[model samples]
Target: MRRVQRVPLDEAARQYLCERQQYARRLLAEDRLRAARFWKDMRETAVFTPVLTALEQMAGPRRRCMYCLDSRGSDVEHFRPKASYPHRMCSWRNLLLCCSDCGRKKGDRFPLDDQGLPLLLDPSADEPWEHLDFDPETGNLTPRFDPTGASSPRGEETVRMLELDQREELALGYQTTYKRLKRELEVALSAGPLDPSALRERLEEADDHGLLPWCLRYGGSTLAPFSTLRQEHPAVWAALSEAV
Candidate 1:
Protein backbone atom coordinates (compact mmCIF):
# COMPACT_ATOMS: atom_id res chain seq x y z
CA MET A 1 0.00 0.00 0.00
CA ARG A 2 1.12 3.51 -0.70
CA ARG A 3 0.02 7.05 0.06
CA VAL A 4 -3.06 7.71 -2.08
CA GLN A 5 -3.29 11.29 -3.17
CA ARG A 6 -6.86 12.45 -2.52
CA VAL A 7 -8.18 14.64 -5.27
CA PRO A 8 -10.64 17.32 -4.35
CA LEU A 9 -14.11 16.90 -5.86
CA ASP A 10 -15.23 19.49 -8.35
CA GLU A 11 -17.98 21.99 -7.49
CA ALA A 12 -20.64 20.27 -9.58
CA ALA A 13 -19.79 16.92 -7.99
CA ARG A 14 -19.81 18.47 -4.55
CA GLN A 15 -23.28 19.92 -5.12
CA TYR A 16 -24.50 16.58 -6.37
CA LEU A 17 -23.12 14.90 -3.24
CA CYS A 18 -24.78 17.45 -0.99
CA GLU A 19 -28.11 16.78 -2.63
CA ARG A 20 -27.60 13.06 -2.30
CA GLN A 21 -26.62 13.30 1.35
CA GLN A 22 -29.77 15.29 2.10
CA TYR A 23 -31.77 12.66 0.26
CA ALA A 24 -30.21 9.86 2.29
CA ARG A 25 -30.94 11.82 5.44
CA ARG A 26 -34.56 12.29 4.37
CA LEU A 27 -34.85 8.58 3.68
CA LEU A 28 -33.43 7.81 7.08
CA ALA A 29 -36.10 10.09 8.47
CA GLU A 30 -38.85 8.01 6.77
CA ASP A 31 -39.48 10.06 3.64
CA ARG A 32 -39.55 6.99 1.42
CA LEU A 33 -40.43 8.67 -1.90
CA ARG A 34 -37.89 11.48 -1.53
CA ALA A 35 -35.29 9.03 -0.26
CA ALA A 36 -35.78 6.77 -3.26
CA ARG A 37 -35.29 9.68 -5.63
CA PHE A 38 -32.10 10.67 -3.80
CA TRP A 39 -30.89 7.09 -3.75
CA LYS A 40 -31.41 6.84 -7.48
CA ASP A 41 -29.33 9.94 -8.18
CA MET A 42 -26.71 8.87 -5.64
CA ARG A 43 -26.43 5.44 -7.21
CA GLU A 44 -26.17 6.93 -10.67
CA THR A 45 -23.42 9.41 -9.84
CA ALA A 46 -21.75 7.40 -7.07
CA VAL A 47 -21.58 4.28 -9.19
CA PHE A 48 -20.95 6.21 -12.37
CA THR A 49 -18.69 9.23 -11.88
CA PRO A 50 -16.76 9.07 -8.57
CA VAL A 51 -15.39 5.66 -9.48
CA LEU A 52 -14.17 6.95 -12.82
CA THR A 53 -12.55 9.94 -11.13
CA ALA A 54 -10.93 7.67 -8.54
CA LEU A 55 -9.42 5.58 -11.31
CA GLU A 56 -8.08 8.72 -12.94
CA GLN A 57 -6.29 9.66 -9.73
CA MET A 58 -5.00 6.16 -8.99
CA ALA A 59 -3.51 5.20 -12.34
CA GLY A 60 -0.18 6.27 -13.73
CA PRO A 61 3.08 4.71 -14.99
CA ARG A 62 3.17 2.74 -11.72
CA ARG A 63 -0.48 1.74 -11.49
CA ARG A 64 -1.20 -0.68 -8.64
CA CYS A 65 -4.00 -2.13 -6.58
CA MET A 66 -4.93 0.42 -3.90
CA TYR A 67 -5.31 -2.24 -1.22
CA CYS A 68 -2.51 -4.73 -1.85
CA LEU A 69 -0.20 -2.61 -4.02
CA ASP A 70 0.65 -5.88 -5.79
CA SER A 71 -1.45 -6.29 -8.94
CA ARG A 72 -2.47 -3.88 -11.64
CA GLY A 73 -5.11 -1.59 -10.17
CA SER A 74 -7.98 -1.83 -12.64
CA ASP A 75 -11.24 -0.67 -10.98
CA VAL A 76 -12.82 1.47 -8.28
CA GLU A 77 -13.53 -0.20 -4.96
CA HIS A 78 -15.90 0.92 -2.23
CA PHE A 79 -13.98 1.31 1.02
CA ARG A 80 -17.19 0.48 2.74
CA PRO A 81 -18.69 -2.40 0.83
CA LYS A 82 -22.00 -1.22 -0.62
CA ALA A 83 -23.74 -4.38 0.55
CA SER A 84 -22.50 -4.15 4.13
CA TYR A 85 -22.11 -0.44 4.74
CA PRO A 86 -24.78 0.96 2.50
CA HIS A 87 -24.99 4.26 4.36
CA ARG A 88 -21.39 4.99 3.35
CA MET A 89 -21.92 3.51 -0.06
CA CYS A 90 -21.48 6.96 -1.60
CA SER A 91 -18.92 8.42 0.80
CA TRP A 92 -15.62 9.58 -0.62
CA ARG A 93 -13.39 8.10 2.09
CA ASN A 94 -15.44 4.96 1.70
CA LEU A 95 -14.29 4.49 -1.88
CA LEU A 96 -10.95 3.15 -3.12
CA LEU A 97 -9.55 2.34 -6.54
CA CYS A 98 -8.22 -1.22 -6.89
CA CYS A 99 -7.39 -4.03 -9.27
CA SER A 100 -9.84 -6.80 -10.16
CA ASP A 101 -7.64 -9.35 -8.38
CA CYS A 102 -7.61 -7.37 -5.12
CA GLY A 103 -11.33 -6.68 -5.44
CA ARG A 104 -11.97 -10.40 -5.70
CA LYS A 105 -9.63 -11.23 -2.83
CA LYS A 106 -11.07 -8.55 -0.55
CA GLY A 107 -14.74 -9.21 -1.35
CA ASP A 108 -16.78 -8.06 1.69
CA ARG A 109 -14.30 -8.98 4.36
CA PHE A 110 -13.74 -5.89 6.54
CA PRO A 111 -12.34 -7.08 9.80
CA LEU A 112 -11.85 -4.84 12.82
CA ASP A 113 -9.49 -5.11 15.75
CA ASP A 114 -10.48 -4.98 19.43
CA GLN A 115 -9.90 -1.24 19.45
CA GLY A 116 -12.35 -0.83 16.55
CA LEU A 117 -9.49 -0.11 14.19
CA PRO A 118 -9.60 -1.69 10.77
CA LEU A 119 -7.23 -4.60 10.32
CA LEU A 120 -6.45 -3.48 6.78
CA LEU A 121 -4.58 -0.28 6.09
CA ASP A 122 -6.48 2.47 4.30
CA PRO A 123 -3.83 3.65 1.85
CA SER A 124 -5.52 7.02 1.64
CA ALA A 125 -5.24 7.51 5.38
CA ASP A 126 -2.15 5.45 6.19
CA GLU A 127 1.16 4.38 4.68
CA PRO A 128 1.16 0.59 4.31
CA TRP A 129 4.92 0.10 4.33
CA GLU A 130 4.93 1.24 7.96
CA HIS A 131 3.42 -2.04 9.09
CA LEU A 132 4.60 -4.17 6.21
CA ASP A 133 7.95 -5.28 4.77
CA PHE A 134 8.83 -6.79 1.42
CA ASP A 135 11.55 -9.31 0.55
CA PRO A 136 12.49 -8.46 -3.01
CA GLU A 137 14.38 -11.72 -3.49
CA THR A 138 11.33 -13.80 -2.59
CA GLY A 139 8.76 -11.13 -3.48
CA ASN A 140 6.75 -12.08 -0.43
CA LEU A 141 5.40 -9.50 2.02
CA THR A 142 5.82 -10.02 5.73
CA PRO A 143 4.78 -8.26 8.90
CA ARG A 144 7.27 -5.61 10.00
CA PHE A 145 9.32 -6.70 12.95
CA ASP A 146 9.53 -4.24 15.80
CA PRO A 147 12.67 -3.71 17.88
CA THR A 148 11.31 -6.32 20.27
CA GLY A 149 11.09 -8.84 17.40
CA ALA A 150 7.31 -8.97 17.56
CA SER A 151 5.61 -8.59 14.19
CA SER A 152 2.95 -6.04 13.46
CA PRO A 153 -0.41 -7.74 13.85
CA ARG A 154 -2.07 -5.48 11.33
CA GLY A 155 0.51 -6.30 8.69
CA GLU A 156 0.32 -10.03 9.36
CA GLU A 157 -3.47 -9.99 9.07
CA THR A 158 -3.39 -8.00 5.84
CA VAL A 159 -0.79 -10.30 4.25
CA ARG A 160 -2.79 -13.36 5.20
CA MET A 161 -6.18 -11.98 4.18
CA LEU A 162 -4.94 -10.85 0.80
CA GLU A 163 -2.61 -13.82 0.44
CA LEU A 164 0.10 -11.30 -0.38
CA ASP A 165 2.83 -13.90 0.05
CA GLN A 166 1.12 -16.89 -1.57
CA ARG A 167 -0.12 -15.13 -4.71
CA GLU A 168 2.35 -16.13 -7.41
CA GLU A 169 1.33 -13.51 -9.97
CA LEU A 170 1.56 -10.66 -7.47
CA ALA A 171 4.88 -11.99 -6.22
CA LEU A 172 6.22 -11.94 -9.78
CA GLY A 173 5.13 -8.36 -10.22
CA TYR A 174 6.95 -7.29 -7.05
CA GLN A 175 9.98 -9.35 -8.06
CA THR A 176 10.16 -7.53 -11.38
CA THR A 177 10.12 -4.14 -9.67
CA TYR A 178 12.55 -5.31 -7.03
CA LYS A 179 15.03 -6.53 -9.62
CA ARG A 180 14.77 -3.30 -11.55
CA LEU A 181 15.37 -1.23 -8.39
CA LYS A 182 18.33 -3.37 -7.28
CA ARG A 183 19.91 -3.12 -10.70
CA GLU A 184 19.52 0.63 -10.65
CA LEU A 185 21.09 0.90 -7.21
CA GLU A 186 23.90 -1.47 -8.09
CA VAL A 187 24.72 0.59 -11.17
CA ALA A 188 24.74 3.76 -9.08
CA LEU A 189 27.16 2.20 -6.61
CA SER A 190 29.47 0.70 -9.28
CA ALA A 191 29.62 3.88 -11.37
CA GLY A 192 32.68 4.83 -9.19
CA PRO A 193 31.67 8.51 -8.89
CA LEU A 194 27.93 8.80 -8.07
CA ASP A 195 25.88 11.97 -8.13
CA PRO A 196 23.50 11.45 -5.24
CA SER A 197 20.73 13.78 -6.40
CA ALA A 198 20.62 12.42 -9.92
CA LEU A 199 20.79 8.86 -8.65
CA ARG A 200 17.96 9.57 -6.19
CA GLU A 201 15.81 10.98 -8.98
CA ARG A 202 16.57 7.98 -11.18
CA LEU A 203 15.77 5.54 -8.40
CA GLU A 204 12.56 7.41 -7.68
CA GLU A 205 11.59 7.03 -11.31
CA ALA A 206 12.28 3.29 -11.22
CA ASP A 207 10.38 2.63 -8.02
CA ASP A 208 6.94 1.25 -8.85
CA HIS A 209 5.77 -0.51 -5.69
CA GLY A 210 6.57 2.42 -3.33
CA LEU A 211 9.28 0.12 -1.98
CA LEU A 212 11.77 2.95 -1.60
CA PRO A 213 10.37 3.81 1.81
CA TRP A 214 10.62 0.22 3.00
CA CYS A 215 14.06 0.04 1.49
CA LEU A 216 15.70 3.21 2.71
CA ARG A 217 13.94 3.44 6.03
CA TYR A 218 13.46 -0.23 6.94
CA GLY A 219 14.72 -2.56 4.21
CA GLY A 220 17.89 -0.56 3.66
CA SER A 221 19.06 -0.86 7.23
CA THR A 222 19.65 -4.63 6.99
CA LEU A 223 19.15 -5.80 3.38
CA ALA A 224 22.15 -6.22 1.00
CA PRO A 225 22.68 -3.38 -1.45
CA PHE A 226 20.91 -1.10 0.96
CA SER A 227 23.12 -2.35 3.77
CA THR A 228 26.19 -2.01 1.59
CA LEU A 229 25.19 1.55 0.70
CA ARG A 230 24.54 2.30 4.35
CA GLN A 231 28.04 1.19 5.30
CA GLU A 232 29.94 2.50 2.26
CA HIS A 233 28.20 5.71 1.28
CA PRO A 234 26.85 7.55 4.27
CA ALA A 235 25.87 10.71 2.36
CA VAL A 236 24.08 8.79 -0.38
CA TRP A 237 22.38 6.60 2.20
CA ALA A 238 21.29 9.66 4.20
CA ALA A 239 19.90 11.37 1.12
CA LEU A 240 17.99 8.27 0.05
CA SER A 241 16.83 7.79 3.63
CA GLU A 242 15.34 11.30 3.69
CA ALA A 243 14.04 11.06 0.12
CA VAL A 244 11.56 8.41 1.17
Candidate 2:
Protein backbone atom coordinates (compact mmCIF):
# COMPACT_ATOMS: atom_id res chain seq x y z
CA MET A 1 0.00 0.00 0.00
CA ARG A 2 1.13 3.54 -0.74
CA ARG A 3 1.43 6.23 1.90
CA VAL A 4 -1.87 8.09 1.65
CA GLN A 5 -1.81 11.87 1.93
CA ARG A 6 -5.03 12.50 3.90
CA VAL A 7 -6.91 15.55 2.76
CA PRO A 8 -8.49 17.52 5.57
CA LEU A 9 -12.27 17.57 5.80
CA ASP A 10 -14.17 20.85 5.46
CA GLU A 11 -15.61 22.66 8.49
CA ALA A 12 -19.10 21.29 7.81
CA ALA A 13 -17.85 17.73 7.49
CA ARG A 14 -15.69 18.10 10.59
CA GLN A 15 -18.67 19.37 12.56
CA TYR A 16 -20.76 16.41 11.42
CA LEU A 17 -18.06 13.97 12.50
CA CYS A 18 -17.68 15.70 15.87
CA GLU A 19 -21.40 15.46 16.50
CA ARG A 20 -21.47 11.79 15.55
CA GLN A 21 -18.51 11.09 17.84
CA GLN A 22 -20.30 12.79 20.72
CA TYR A 23 -23.42 10.71 20.06
CA ALA A 24 -21.39 7.51 19.90
CA ARG A 25 -19.53 8.44 23.06
CA ARG A 26 -22.78 8.88 24.95
CA LEU A 27 -24.14 5.54 23.72
CA LEU A 28 -20.91 3.80 24.63
CA ALA A 29 -20.83 5.42 28.07
CA GLU A 30 -24.38 4.13 28.75
CA ASP A 31 -23.36 0.65 27.47
CA ARG A 32 -26.21 0.88 24.94
CA LEU A 33 -24.08 0.88 21.78
CA ARG A 34 -24.44 -1.88 19.16
CA ALA A 35 -21.58 -1.48 16.70
CA ALA A 36 -23.46 -2.78 13.66
CA ARG A 37 -26.52 -0.64 14.38
CA PHE A 38 -24.40 2.45 14.97
CA TRP A 39 -22.55 2.00 11.68
CA LYS A 40 -25.80 1.37 9.79
CA ASP A 41 -27.29 4.55 11.24
CA MET A 42 -24.21 6.55 10.33
CA ARG A 43 -24.32 5.25 6.76
CA GLU A 44 -27.93 6.38 6.46
CA THR A 45 -27.18 9.95 7.56
CA ALA A 46 -26.87 12.74 4.97
CA VAL A 47 -23.55 13.91 6.44
CA PHE A 48 -21.98 10.47 5.93
CA THR A 49 -22.38 10.90 2.17
CA PRO A 50 -19.77 13.64 2.09
CA VAL A 51 -17.46 11.55 4.27
CA LEU A 52 -17.69 8.69 1.77
CA THR A 53 -16.97 11.08 -1.09
CA ALA A 54 -13.94 12.45 0.75
CA LEU A 55 -12.62 8.90 1.25
CA GLU A 56 -13.05 8.16 -2.43
CA GLN A 57 -11.19 11.35 -3.28
CA MET A 58 -8.31 10.22 -1.11
CA ALA A 59 -8.21 6.88 -2.99
CA GLY A 60 -7.65 8.72 -6.30
CA PRO A 61 -9.64 8.62 -9.59
CA ARG A 62 -9.93 4.82 -9.75
CA ARG A 63 -10.84 4.67 -6.05
CA ARG A 64 -8.36 1.86 -5.40
CA CYS A 65 -8.47 0.02 -2.07
CA MET A 66 -6.13 1.60 0.51
CA TYR A 67 -4.93 -1.81 1.68
CA CYS A 68 -4.25 -3.68 -1.59
CA LEU A 69 -4.32 -0.79 -4.09
CA ASP A 70 -5.61 -3.40 -6.58
CA SER A 71 -9.42 -3.57 -6.45
CA ARG A 72 -11.89 -0.68 -6.50
CA GLY A 73 -12.52 0.68 -3.02
CA SER A 74 -16.29 0.24 -2.58
CA ASP A 75 -16.83 1.12 1.06
CA VAL A 76 -15.52 3.08 4.06
CA GLU A 77 -13.48 0.83 6.39
CA HIS A 78 -12.86 1.31 10.08
CA PHE A 79 -9.17 1.12 10.94
CA ARG A 80 -9.98 0.10 14.50
CA PRO A 81 -12.78 -2.43 14.62
CA LYS A 82 -15.97 -0.54 15.54
CA ALA A 83 -17.20 -3.36 17.79
CA SER A 84 -14.07 -3.05 19.95
CA TYR A 85 -13.62 0.73 19.76
CA PRO A 86 -17.13 2.18 19.62
CA HIS A 87 -15.95 5.61 20.75
CA ARG A 88 -13.96 5.97 17.55
CA MET A 89 -16.85 4.75 15.40
CA CYS A 90 -17.26 8.05 13.60
CA SER A 91 -13.76 9.43 13.97
CA TRP A 92 -12.38 10.60 10.61
CA ARG A 93 -8.89 9.30 11.29
CA ASN A 94 -10.29 5.82 11.96
CA LEU A 95 -11.84 5.53 8.50
CA LEU A 96 -10.36 4.28 5.23
CA LEU A 97 -11.46 3.28 1.73
CA CYS A 98 -11.32 -0.47 1.16
CA CYS A 99 -12.42 -3.16 -1.24
CA SER A 100 -15.05 -5.71 -0.22
CA ASP A 101 -12.55 -8.59 -0.22
CA CYS A 102 -10.18 -6.74 2.10
CA GLY A 103 -13.03 -5.63 4.32
CA ARG A 104 -14.18 -9.21 4.72
CA LYS A 105 -10.68 -10.51 5.36
CA LYS A 106 -9.98 -7.82 7.99
CA GLY A 107 -13.35 -7.91 9.73
CA ASP A 108 -13.06 -7.40 13.50
CA ARG A 109 -9.46 -8.58 13.59
CA PHE A 110 -7.16 -5.88 14.97
CA PRO A 111 -3.83 -7.21 16.17
CA LEU A 112 -1.59 -5.28 18.57
CA ASP A 113 2.03 -5.43 19.66
CA ASP A 114 3.37 -6.10 23.16
CA GLN A 115 3.25 -2.37 23.77
CA GLY A 116 -0.40 -2.18 22.59
CA LEU A 117 0.54 -0.49 19.31
CA PRO A 118 -1.36 -1.66 16.20
CA LEU A 119 0.57 -4.22 14.16
CA LEU A 120 -1.33 -3.39 10.99
CA LEU A 121 0.05 -0.58 8.84
CA ASP A 122 -2.19 2.47 8.59
CA PRO A 123 -1.51 3.68 5.07
CA SER A 124 -2.66 7.23 5.88
CA ALA A 125 -0.38 7.45 8.93
CA ASP A 126 2.60 5.21 8.09
CA GLU A 127 4.88 4.61 5.12
CA PRO A 128 4.15 1.02 4.06
CA TRP A 129 7.39 0.50 2.13
CA GLU A 130 9.33 0.79 5.40
CA HIS A 131 7.68 -2.39 6.68
CA LEU A 132 6.72 -4.21 3.46
CA ASP A 133 8.88 -5.63 0.67
CA PHE A 134 7.75 -6.25 -2.91
CA ASP A 135 8.87 -9.18 -5.08
CA PRO A 136 9.16 -8.21 -8.73
CA GLU A 137 9.28 -11.82 -9.90
CA THR A 138 6.21 -13.10 -8.07
CA GLY A 139 4.47 -9.74 -7.64
CA ASN A 140 3.89 -10.73 -4.02
CA LEU A 141 4.16 -8.37 -1.05
CA THR A 142 5.98 -9.72 2.00
CA PRO A 143 7.41 -8.32 5.21
CA ARG A 144 10.52 -6.22 4.76
CA PHE A 145 13.64 -7.83 6.19
CA ASP A 146 15.46 -6.08 9.03
CA PRO A 147 19.20 -5.96 9.61
CA THR A 148 18.89 -9.14 11.72
CA GLY A 149 17.40 -11.04 8.74
CA ALA A 150 13.93 -11.20 10.27
CA SER A 151 10.73 -9.90 8.64
CA SER A 152 9.04 -6.82 10.04
CA PRO A 153 6.35 -7.98 12.47
CA ARG A 154 3.98 -5.24 11.46
CA GLY A 155 4.43 -6.03 7.78
CA GLU A 156 3.97 -9.73 8.33
CA GLU A 157 0.75 -9.15 10.24
CA THR A 158 -0.60 -6.71 7.67
CA VAL A 159 0.14 -9.05 4.77
CA ARG A 160 -1.39 -12.00 6.58
CA MET A 161 -4.50 -10.03 7.49
CA LEU A 162 -4.98 -8.76 3.96
CA GLU A 163 -3.71 -11.93 2.21
CA LEU A 164 -1.50 -9.70 0.07
CA ASP A 165 0.94 -12.46 -0.82
CA GLN A 166 -1.64 -15.09 -1.73
CA ARG A 167 -4.19 -13.34 -3.93
CA GLU A 168 -3.78 -14.45 -7.54
CA GLU A 169 -5.65 -11.50 -9.06
CA LEU A 170 -3.76 -8.99 -6.91
CA ALA A 171 -0.42 -10.52 -7.91
CA LEU A 172 -1.34 -10.31 -11.58
CA GLY A 173 -2.32 -6.67 -11.24
CA TYR A 174 0.94 -5.77 -9.52
CA GLN A 175 2.96 -7.65 -12.15
CA THR A 176 1.18 -5.82 -14.97
CA THR A 177 1.90 -2.46 -13.34
CA TYR A 178 5.56 -3.36 -12.78
CA LYS A 179 6.00 -4.32 -16.42
CA ARG A 180 4.41 -1.07 -17.55
CA LEU A 181 6.70 0.96 -15.29
CA LYS A 182 9.76 -0.95 -16.53
CA ARG A 183 8.80 -0.45 -20.18
CA GLU A 184 8.26 3.27 -19.63
CA LEU A 185 11.70 3.72 -18.05
CA GLU A 186 13.44 1.63 -20.68
CA VAL A 187 11.86 3.67 -23.46
CA ALA A 188 12.89 6.92 -21.77
CA LEU A 189 16.49 5.72 -21.35
CA SER A 190 16.73 4.66 -25.01
CA ALA A 191 15.58 8.14 -26.08
CA GLY A 192 18.81 9.72 -24.75
CA PRO A 193 19.23 12.73 -22.37
CA LEU A 194 16.07 12.83 -20.28
CA ASP A 195 13.85 15.80 -19.56
CA PRO A 196 13.20 15.40 -15.81
CA SER A 197 9.76 17.04 -15.81
CA ALA A 198 8.55 15.10 -18.84
CA LEU A 199 9.96 11.84 -17.51
CA ARG A 200 8.28 12.37 -14.10
CA GLU A 201 4.90 12.98 -15.68
CA ARG A 202 5.22 9.93 -17.91
CA LEU A 203 6.23 7.64 -15.07
CA GLU A 204 3.48 8.95 -12.80
CA GLU A 205 0.94 8.25 -15.51
CA ALA A 206 2.22 4.71 -15.98
CA ASP A 207 2.39 4.01 -12.23
CA ASP A 208 -1.17 2.71 -11.84
CA HIS A 209 -0.34 0.63 -8.71
CA GLY A 210 1.77 3.18 -6.81
CA LEU A 211 5.04 1.25 -7.33
CA LEU A 212 7.17 4.33 -7.93
CA PRO A 213 7.70 5.02 -4.22
CA TRP A 214 8.70 1.37 -3.64
CA CYS A 215 11.02 1.49 -6.65
CA LEU A 216 12.73 4.65 -5.49
CA ARG A 217 13.01 3.97 -1.74
CA TYR A 218 13.45 0.19 -1.48
CA GLY A 219 14.92 -2.87 -3.25
CA GLY A 220 13.57 -1.65 -6.59
CA SER A 221 16.49 0.73 -7.02
CA THR A 222 18.82 -2.27 -7.23
CA LEU A 223 16.86 -3.78 -10.15
CA ALA A 224 17.28 -3.27 -13.88
CA PRO A 225 16.41 0.02 -15.65
CA PHE A 226 16.41 1.79 -12.27
CA SER A 227 19.92 0.50 -11.41
CA THR A 228 21.20 1.31 -14.87
CA LEU A 229 19.80 4.82 -14.68
CA ARG A 230 21.24 5.43 -11.22
CA GLN A 231 24.68 4.22 -12.31
CA GLU A 232 24.90 5.87 -15.73
CA HIS A 233 23.03 9.10 -15.04
CA PRO A 234 23.29 10.20 -11.44
CA ALA A 235 21.91 13.66 -12.23
CA VAL A 236 18.80 12.25 -13.95
CA TRP A 237 18.22 9.68 -11.22
CA ALA A 238 18.45 12.36 -8.53
CA ALA A 239 15.94 14.55 -10.35
CA LEU A 240 13.55 11.64 -10.95
CA SER A 241 13.83 10.47 -7.35
CA GLU A 242 13.10 13.94 -5.97
CA ALA A 243 10.13 14.48 -8.27
CA VAL A 244 8.51 11.11 -7.39
Which one wins on TM-score?
Answer: 2
C-alpha lDDT (0 to 100) for residue 207 of candidate 2: 81
Which pairs clash (backbone N, Cα, C closer than 3 Å) in model 1?
Answer: 79-94, 215-220
The residue-by-residue lDDT of candidate 1 on 138-241, one tens digit each, is 88888889889998888988887778888887778778777777789888888888788988888878777777777777865687787888889988889878
Q: Could you tell me how far off, in angstroms, the CA of residue 119 lies in candidate 1 after the best superposition? A: 0.9
TM-score of each: 0.85, 0.97
Q: What is the C-alpha RMSD of each candidate to the true structure, in Å?
A: 3.2, 1.0
Question: Candidate 2 at 209: error in angstroms?
Answer: 1.4
> Which residue ranges in model 2 land beyond 4 Å of their true spot?
none
Positional deviation of 137 in candidate 1, in angstroms?
3.8
- Model 2 RMSD to the real structure? 1.0
lDDT of 2 by residue, 83-202 (tens): 898888889999999999999999999999999999999999998989999998899999999889998999999999999999999999989999998899999999988988888888
lDDT of each: 0.74, 0.90
Backbone clashes in model 2 = 0
Clashing residue pairs, candidate 2?
Answer: none
